[model samples]
Every structure is written in C-alpha cells, then in structure tokens.
Target: MAAFRDPLAGFVPDALVLVALDNALSRGWPDAAVSDLTRDILHASGIADGTVPAPAFAALLGDGRADLVARVRFLRMALGDLALGFDALTGDLPTFMDRAQTFGLFRYDKAMSDTAAARAEVRPWVDYVSALTRLEAAHLVPRLPGNAGPDWLEIGGNSGAFAAAICAARADVRITVSDLPAVCGLGQEMQKGQDRIRFQPRDARKSGWAAELGARDLLLFKSVLHDWPDHHARAFLTEAVACLEPGGRIVICERGPFAAGLADASFLSRLANAVFAPFYRDPSVYEGWLRAAGFAPTRQTVQLDMPFHVIEAVRA
Candidate 1:
C-alpha cells in the first residue's frame, strides 16, 4: 500500500524555487555572492520530483562554460522580465504566436524547404548555428582529446566555424569541413582567412559518401545527428566507422533530450522551449548506434548553459 499525495501540492516548492531564482537574478549572475546563492538553488530539496536538471545549472562553475552562461543571460534579458505581465497563462500565447507568425517564422522555414533554392538571407537557422560557433565551440574543443591528431574531419559541418574554432585552438591540427555545395560556398567565404581549415562540398545524404574521405584521426558530428531519424543516424555512424584510423575517435556532440520539467524556475522559459528544443536525444540511444558501428562509446554531459552530451567512441 502507498500513501496518497496531494495532487496540487507540488507547486509549493516550485514557488519557493521561483522566489530564489528571482532573488538571484536581482543580484545578477556575474555579481558577487551569486555563486553561493546559486549553489543553494541547485541543492535545495523540494517536494516536486521534477525540478530543474541540476547538471546544467551546476556547469556554470566549470571552465570555458562562461560563454554559454553569457548567452543564457542575454536570452533571459531578451525575453524580458515576467513581472506583472500576461504570460501564456493569461491568454498571451495565442496572440503572441499569431503575431510571431506574421514576422515570417513559418515563411522562413518554407523558404529553406526549397531544395533547389534555399534563401541564404533568411537563414532561419542563423541563431542556432551562431550559438554553435560563438557560444558552444570554445567549450566543445577542450573536451575533445589530444588524439584528435592533425587530420580532423567534421561531417555535415555548417559554415565550418566549429572546425575553425578547433584549428584556432590547436595550431598543429588541420581540419576539413564537409557539407552541401551551397553551404560549402558560404563556409569558404566566411572561413577564408583560416589557412588550416578548408571546406569540401559533399552531400552526406548520398550513398557511399565516405569512400573518398580518406583516413582520419577523428571524425566529429557536432549537433548534427538529432535532426536525423534513428535509422539514418545509425546508418550514418556505420558509414563513418570505416573512415577513421584504428585508434581514431568519433565524437558526437548533441543536446540532451528536452523534458517538460522546468530547468529554471521560470514558466516562461519552459513555454518557449515547448516551441521545440531542437536537440532531441538520449545518450543511450547513441550508445547503441556506436556499438553497431564498431566502437566502444563513453558518454559525458557538460553544462553549456543547457546540458550537452559529448559521446566519444573509439574505433576498434
């Protein structure tokens, strides 16, 4: 027999967590005494089983994670203060969505859907891709092992910025970023000054894609797999297995699966994420893919404002 719990009772601690988060914000994240207060918010126990994920919040203390924290801080400001305002709870969402749609969010996606002529100016994915290069890249490079060697390959790398960041960090490492022809052209122009980083036009969707890739010390799939269905992701990993040296590594950097559970005390943030938290995956799911692809995988979740899983698989 189990004791019955109050159905609406969970909101109590949720409310307290909200209070603490609000107080923390007033002092601000970069201000003195914030870290201690943050620790309290993270460790504070509550009745609700679904509190914010602790790892993402705890990650602010780690090295090189500041860039992501800054990005999160800016986003918090961009969303504006929720005080004395109508959240979706008060019927703002219906009207807000209607207005945001008018700004061409759907139109932008529609433009990109055209295979023969995807508009570059609209760049529906610019914010996401920019976060990769500007915010997450610095944090990503440090986690990759030194065995990444001189020859590194990034499959489906857009704009080649991740590879550029790696090359900038490691003078000895040369990298090649492979993507569609259109993206390659843009990447070539954007990455022009970087001597060690180059772009190659390759449609990863085509069969026998890796036959000409040559041997490489490391192959990376940075935030690329989640958009793919499981079968495609598994098939791509199988194809990638043959492209690496015996001791070479395959590093997959992806966002952890999104849960409706609030990661912050803010309901507004959760509401925004409900729109779509692009990185949808479980590290275990990738483990199965790695096993079938002929490598032993090890997983890590690093806090880059939001939690990101770095799965490393070493070739057998």
Candidate 2:
C-alpha cells in the first residue's frame, strides 16, 4: 500500500468511484477474472516502458477496444488506490466502511431511512467527515471579514462539527445548523454543553425554510449545493440570500469541476466524473447564481491540488 504523509492525504478517490466499482462487481465480475485482465492490459500497454500517458490509459478503458474484463480491472485498480489513499490518511478502514455503508450512494435509497437504526448507522460517518471538514473550516472562517458578525447559519450542517470548530475558534460566535430532523437531532446530541451551537430541522427545498431563521450575518453551504442540479441550486441560493442580513455573507465550499485538472487526472478523478457528472459544476456557474441572487462575489479560492473550491459572496 502506498503511504501518504500529508495530513489531508493529498487526494483520496471520490466516494462516487467506489459506488461505480461496487455496482460493476455486483453485476457479476469476479476478483480473479479482473486480476487476470489487469495483468494482460499491463503487458499489452507496455507500462514497463512508462511511455503511456493518462489519455492513452483513458482510451484503453473507454474506447471499447479493450475487453469488458480489462476495463473492469482498470476501474477496480482506481478504486483500490482510493481505498489505500484514504487508509493512508485516516488509518481506520473499519470506520470508513461503516460510513461508506451508511452513505449508500450506490443504492437506490442512497441513505438510510429515518428509523432509529438508520440514525445509529449513519451518525459515526457524519461525525468522521465533519471532523475532517472542520479542519478546512478553521482555515477559512478567520479569513472572512470581521464585520460579518457573530451569528452563523450552516445549511445542511451535519453533526455540528463545522459549527463546533467555528465556535471553538471564537467563543462568542453563535452557530445554528439547519438540516433534516434526524440529522438535526444527531447534531443536537453531539453538541450538548456547547450552548453556542444549535441544530434546527430544515429542508432546503421547502419554501421559506430560510425565512424562518429571520436574518443571519453569515450563511454557510459547505458541500451542500453540489448535490442538486442547476434549477434547484439557483432556488437555494435565492433563498439563502433572503435569509442573509443586509451586508451579510454566504460561503459555499464544494468539490469543483472534475475536468479542471484533466492533464494529470488520476484514474479516480476520471471515474468520479463518470459517476457524478450531474452533481458537479464549474465554479463560474456558481458565480452566475450568486449574481442572479443579488450577491456579489467577494472572494474565491480554488485549491487545485486538494480539488475543492470556496466561494464567498456578499449581499449587494
């Protein structure tokens, strides 16, 4: 297994890749068959000479010139790299599996039901990812204008991890995390004793969800908007703008366009795009939506290596 020393592990394969890999396997490909095909492709491509580039590799996988078994093997290796990369960063495969199973992105349901069992299964994964996102938030929150005020509202905030991180950084910052009722309950439970952080049940699509909150100085939508397609995303932004206080800010942090770094795109990156094309969008699309919502882009940071973008916009 390759070892990654960076705290964030540079890049882990997107969860979407794992979903595609699992789907292919479930459809009947065997491990031994994939392994044999992988060996054949390596010999045919003359990978030993190291002359084959990423596009060539992508062609081999997608041009239909290669056999189905070979293509499946190629995908498997990419998914394996993601697994190894995540393990290298966190050193906890069992925990990752628990989260992966609960997330169920490959399944038709795509998440557990609202039963107690569902909450129990999903909470740990939410907590784990939230903790990781909190590190990023720590770097980002301080960069916002000091005039933004102490009131913070996080849309789709899960388990209150980001809110907790913000409150920890500045004790007076009050945080309200809006999410589904089950998720809100889990966050409320996790944030007990931290009176500054609160979770409210909300569905972002429902009209007036943001209106219920009155006005907030800073609204956060971390890894949230990308889950929806354009029309819904635009509507959410409009609602978010209405929720903001005059001169308030809305911060969006999400996975940016997959093709931006295609010159050196890893197998995982390509597979992520294949699986999540509908959910991913270029940052310019976000800029347009912000302007449409009557907000002006104030700051934008694209972390090309880590492959995420943070766009901060303020009400005009």
Candidate 3:
C-alpha cells in the first residue's frame, strides 16, 4: 500500500497531463503509459486549465482506479523533477526531453527533435564561434602527425553517441568513451559493432581509475565540464592535462556566453543552467582555468547549431 500511495504525496497533475498528451514513449510500456492515465485524471478532475490537482486527485485515487492510479503513479515518479506550471503543463509539449528536461525519462524522438531545435535556434555569430572554441581541441585530429594515429579518451560520454560517430568517421582514431558504470553500460550497448570505440567506467571527479586515462593526443570533454562546480571542473582539467601526450590537446564543448544583444541565447542560457547545473561559464573564466591547468589556448568558437563554446587547448 505504501508503495502504491508513495507517488501521490507530491503529485503535479498538470505535468502528468502534459506527459499524457505528448506520449512519445519510443521506449516500451509502462514507460509510455503516461498519456492515457493523465487524460482520465484531467478529464475527471475538471481543472479546465490543466493544472495538477490537490483535492481532486485524492478523490480519484480513492475510488479504486487502479490502472489510472498506476499510470499516473509512473508518470509522477518519472517527471517529479519538472516543477511544471499550469501553462507549461497544458501547452503543447516538446516531442523529446533530454538531460535538460529534468525528467527521468529520455525519450529518443524528443531528444533528436530537441537537438535539431537547439541547432536551428543558435544564431549569433560570436556565440557560434565561441562554441567552436572547445571543439578545437578535438579538431586537432586533422593536425595529427598525419600518419601516426592517436588514441583518445572521451570523458563523461553519455551514451557514446558522439564517440561512435567520431569513430565511424575517423578510422585512425581509437576513442575510449568513459562515464559512470550505468552510462558506460548503455554506451557499450550502443557501440556494439564499432571496433574503434570502447566504453569504460571512469568517474572524473574523485580520485579513482580516472588517473589511468594516460597520454593521449586528445582528451574529449565533449559537453561535461559545466555540470560541475569550479573546483571539480578544475580538478578534471588538471587530470585531463596530465593524461595528454606532449602537444596533446583538450577539446571541450560547454555552454558559454553569447554575443551581445542576442535574445534567443538568453533563453538558451537559462535552459542550459537549469539543465546542466553549476552554471555555465564566462569565456574568460574558462580560459583562465585552461591556462592555469598548463594548457595553451588555441581556439574558441560557438558553432551555428550548438549553444556550446567549443574550446581547444594544447597541454603546455
């Protein structure tokens, strides 16, 4: 009974309704079962505006609506982090929810759509250039000795998606993508037939096996640093620097400031902070950290399709 009633204590009815309406559970049920349940509860609660219920929910749950209760229970538990408002709950939902959505579920369709939307939305020239700054470290691939291939490490690689993509594109580079155990499991699964990509678990924060990430031509921080506070980020950079080969590079893709007077970027900034945590950085601060970590800054740019500043630096 406690297990069943647990989800009701902090129910956000509107978010449930929104989840129901936008059920793109490209994954299987009960994961995709939010919509039907939300519809029933919203219709019965008669909130009209689609806000979550307080009293109405109690009544609905008390009436032995087990299936409805179960469905709502699942969605409420899944989306508990959303803190959704009535308008957001009722508005047409985005098709995908990524790490930014604050929701536990990672709807594939929504993630792809959100990525596409993010790319289309980034517009300012300086902002785009800033994104490419972090990419510069990874871009060193082209500058490699041309014949002597370099093995690389992709720290905090979520599902090895980008790593696999990179491996597929570059035969000369062997990328070992590392993350937490569970994420590495997912990445391992995703990288199944790819010989150039290997998945491993290496926590970049505390002292662990991460120190073994040794002497590679490039250290890929793809889109990870901003998720941590300054101290942790600094430690990560120091560790990465130590692991690079002479003339080795560090490439980072992180949320950074946009050019002056860009309205769209303001929204993106807020969204990234809310999603990525610890807040994104000013370019100067990031560059400072890079320099202090014994890296020589090379390039910084914001890619047209991304909100991140791509930064490249060489280990000095």
lDDT string for model 3 (1-316, tens) is: 0111223323333554435432422222233343545546555535222333345554544543443433333434434433543234334333223222343332222222223343223212112222223223344333333332368888877666667556655777888887655555555654688888887666676564335665688888865676567888888888887777777787776656433214543222322233323255766677788988777775555433234456778757
How do the residues 93-210 of candidate 1 rate in per-residue lDDT, one tens digit apiece? 4554444422233233333232435536424343336444565676777878776668888987877878888888889999889876666666777688989888777767666756
Name the candidate, 1 or 3, with the larger lDDT value: 1
Locate the minimum summed-lDDT window of 10 residues in model 2: 1-10
On the 0 to 100 scale, the lDDT of residue 202 in model 3 is 60
Q: lDDT for model 1, on a 0 to 1 scale?
A: 0.61
- Lowest lDDT 10-mer window, candidate 3? 1-10
Global local distance difference test of model 2:
0.60
Return the TM-score for each candidate structure.
0.62, 0.63, 0.55
Cα lDDT for residue 35, candidate 3? 51
Per-residue CA lDDT of model 2 for 244-295, tens digit only, reads 8778898888767656656655554464333333366777889888987777
The clash number for model 1 is: 0
Clashes within 3 Å, all models in order: 0, 0, 29
RMSD of each: 11.8, 12.6, 15.3
